[model samples]
Target: MANGIPLDGGRHAGTPTVGIVGLGLIGGSLARRLVARGIGVVAWNHRPHPYAEAERDGIRCAATLGELVDAGPDLIVLCNPLKAMPGVLVGLRPLLASRPRITLTDVGSVKGMVRQQVEAAGLGDRYVGAHPMAGNEHSGWQAADPALYDGALWALTVTPGTDYARFLAVARFVTEGVGNRIIALDDTTHDQAAALISHMPHVVATALVNTLVADPDRNIAAALAAGSWRDMTRVALTDPERTRAMVEEDSRNVAALLRAMAARLTGVADALDAYDDRALTAFFALGQPFREYKARERAAALAGAERQPEERTLAIPAEGWQETLLASARHGERLVCLAGDHTAVVTAAGMD
Candidate 1:
């Protein structure tokens, strides 16, 4: 599947050298993975001292962005803080002319802005936006793991400016080297979907846990803590600045989801007040399967040391002619909805 696409053009075949621009968890993990596979890695970090850590790990260290560029790596993986990309882009732009023709990707959680910057810089053909749906509470190189990407679902966002061939090459490289399955989408859709699933959930979990802790008898709730409470609030322990940037930058989408959740909660409270045992029971039952599905999905993604099969193409069709055509071209696929509109009559299919 590598298909003879040179990661670094000047290098001979079987050379798996990769350049990483940051020494954070994502960057360091990628470096470790390449080195473990017998691939050379040349990495750089803005903080000079981190180079010592990279040296200790036997990974090559570049003193400047130019040095990394000159090293002629096949791939340049960007792993800096999400908020720091714009500034880094400014500094890296001058080196673009001198840089080798290597495929580029970023591990930024949010893609819209990064996509925009890549396009603005006229490097769209070589750059792809990537988000590996995995991380830990800790940050920095100290938390790096070669297997961090195993079984994770990584979203590879291809904007209009991207080169399709390079996109496919990068996708295959990710699955083969990083051990992640690829989910493809355009930049806008990717960002919106992430805002709904990844960003909004974090805010909701943090808010729910904080609310419970605000009670004068908060310690009592802590004493009652179990796996469920801890599981639900695990994301609240992520890096605060990272979470804040995600929420604030995509405020519109996150806020919309939050409002919908508030409405659902209010409906549940109303049902309880009216002694509607049937409605409350229905709500509980509806949530049960969702919880079960989530547990199964999580287990599937992190089940073993081996990487999962790459997910090729998956689409959800809208109720329109346009969606029908798009689905057909995307493949002979049917969009199955598990849940209907909230106000619709409850049916078995909806529950399923």
Candidate 2:
């Protein structure tokens, strides 16, 4: 197989084409968005219905995994569940053996195990693990939306040995094409942080729903449930099989976080039982600042989305002029001096 094939147009012109395996929620949404942005997408799905739908929508649907590889994608995204990845990687090894320049990534929540598997398969340089921190409780291609990834944080796992050029290419596609913020983290750090923010919370939501459903007055309580209960347990409505697979893959980290949550809950129960007003007040107060901080973060993210800057390259006289321009630039403006003959780049910032 050829190492690189010019897709969409010339090798470096137009949008980069991507091959996506598993046309589920994330993959389907990605296809829609990329197609809308004029990027070519060749997709393969295990299910017959979604494959037909993709074909009907003008997306090149590969009849087999091998055919998808034959389509010559610059990037291949494995969108299957966490446990299914190792097998998928193994299967793709023979097809990808000669295509070292083709970058591969995934949308799996956990990263450490995936990174290990990629390295074991001798694809460490060709693969980067990505987890987009965006999704609904819904599953399958039917629920996929083109705007699903907008303004979301897409975490990319980068280790010391990671291919920086490949990583940057993927990062550019994710940010400029997908409209997501790129957060680069190590595999271990990504897994640990995902456990606390996503995996553990998912377990808690499911457990809460289980506890409520098992109660004698469950139906009545459910009928009376307000936004607090609904918001907290919304993730519990996600596909059970998918959730089980994800949690099982990262059980150790989730379990440890669950234990801490249990201990904290116990202390809260004790405070309530003893009617410790001061302790209750302190506990409640502690959460207020964090809640406010998160609100501010959301606002800032929205502002950033609205104020995306445009980059421009210009020929300058000397390096000193570029440095002077950088010093005089506003808060969000960024200037970089290139290595070539008096070339400088400026990213216009805070422009509406």
Candidate 3:
């Protein structure tokens, strides 16, 4: 088994082709990584600036979205900004109507909203939702690097109505093509988890900077700032407009997470004010599980790349397949690849 996949896990006979909608950070990085791994990629960006560079990197640059479709990619990944999703979907609707075999998916941060827009465009049947857990505080093709996907994990969002073949296509694209791991989830579960882990924290990082700016002694604090501050506030360096758009698209989830986070902060403040040692201890203790989990991750990294603990084969059921994948993901199992239509090879739950 190469790249953690079984000999029978090859989902396609040859290197699969992909169509990219945007050439920004995430899309460009994926294109570069896939191409480096010998997968064929045809990409179209809203602007032609990235085309020259993308072509130089061996990615076929399409002059138009229609031209991208002409490449007959097995999967077309929508990497456009969330705001442009509706319009992009509108354009693709007519073009893709005759190409039902071409599975549609996106790298959108907010799956539920993207799925809604896809459904609104009457293309839901041809769509699956995907969000790769990769990226950085960068934008555009210039910032793109294939290394961005190193050890990346992706979430493939699905519903009961999603075609197993379509889901398999995207799964293979991630696992076999991109050489990444996959966790299956529904849109809501993905969105909520993303909000809790990513969106809310981005906002909190921004708030940290705002707090610094509001302080009259900010220059002094800045001079004394160290690694802890940098680690906590790094995401605040992301393009503000892009961050706002991401937070807004998943507004409900982000807002709810913000409320919960605020309560935690307030409790900490109250505890500190009262000098309650027990409350402070409890607050600190709450995170020990996560800390231990992260420690294990670091240990695993040192254990060598070839070591796959609790790796096991899963026989996918013909019925309740979606739930089967979702349940596995919920418990932190990652699908390495599909061995066959009714078979999945997975790694142990990460939290185990």
Candidate 4:
């Protein structure tokens, strides 16, 4: 479709209008990308100034949420914080019956709760849960960039009643538009996965920084700190309230992860206190391989993200299935057989 965001298999090509609620970093970035692609973007912010700011950036500013809702944009993206969405939904629900025919999605970090709120508010079919794995320690429009989504993994949560076709359309629109990877996950899976990869990591980073900062001998530690310490603690600068809110919202999962981590830390401490050189050496020995694997994984993810829209594709059957593989191959689809068990395997050629 428009904006060079690659479409999935059996997708149509066309530009679509989009409405964005909230003009913070995520919404502002989305507006810029959508506008760049010739897609109409009508946006609303509680603060009147963001509207003016967006106007200066070539985005249409709506005076009110009603104006934005009535615009009938093909999709409405909500970029408010998770805690803030319930109130936004309360405000938007009354207008649902009269709401424009459009796809609805949110950029909330947590999926389970937000999806529940949308469905509870009777906005089921129209709503999708979205999470962009991109952000900055600094927040607001000044940090907004259409390129912010570049090379990021944006998760789309698939819940019951979610329209699959429209969901795919939205996924393609975001991923292909601003260099990004789209990962589809169920609500529970999304939250747990994010807890391990994002939430827990942030907590650790912040804790590391806090521990250093609170030390009476902080100067000694800071003087001895190297790139590894700096890199590990960088995310500690992220807004505390936001992180705390996220931890509290998904407390169960976060707690479980944290407890497991704590148990491991306890083991390390016990080993150290007991002067167990064997245990200490065993623990330290694993760091090198873990670091190597992490580096490779990150590199691979970055490389996959560099794949262009021209490399976009979906798998189709290869030759000998029924006729020639010409139709599939012509569309850049490749196929392979899954003869192991009882399933069929088709590999897409263009995509990495």
What TM-score goes with each of the models?
Answer: 0.79, 0.81, 0.94, 0.78
**CA lDDT for candidate 2:** 0.74
Q: Across residues 1-352, which tens digit of lDDT does each residue of candidate 2 receive?
A: 1222233345533333788888889989988877776677888887668877777666788888888888888789888766777788888898999777679999989998888898888888888788988789888899878889875767777676666556655665675556555555677777888899888999999999999989999999999999999999999998878788888888899999999999989988999999999888988887776677667656666888675446666454433442333232423334332323344455543322
C-alpha lDDT (0 to 100) for residue 123 of candidate 2: 86
Cα lDDT computed for each candidate against the true fold? 0.69, 0.74, 0.87, 0.69
Q: List, residue by residue over 1-352, the lDDT tens digit for candidate 4.
A: 3322233323332233677888788788878877776566788887877766778777888787778777666677898777778888888877667753567788888889888898888887887678888877777777788887765666777654555455645665564444455555677877898899888888999889889999999999999999999889877877799889878878888889999999989999999899999998988886786677667656665878575223333332332322222344334343332222222233343321
Model 1 stretches astray by more than 4 angstroms: 1-16, 287-352
Off by over 4 Å in 3: 1-16
The superposed Cα distance between candidate 2 and the true structure at residue 124, in angstroms, equals 1.3
Candidate 3 lDDT, tens digit per residue, 45-133?
99999887888888998899899998878789999898999999999988898887788999999899999999999999878899999
Measured by lDDT, the strongest candidate is 3
Q: For candidate 3, give the lDDT of residue 279.
A: 95
Ten contiguous residues minimizing lDDT sum, candidate 4: 335-344
Q: How many clashes does the backbone of model 3 have?
A: 0
Clashes of 2: 0
Residue clash pairs of candidate 3: none
Off by over 4 Å in 4: 1-16, 275-278, 285-352
Clashes of each: 2, 0, 0, 2
Better of 3 and 4 by lDDT: 3
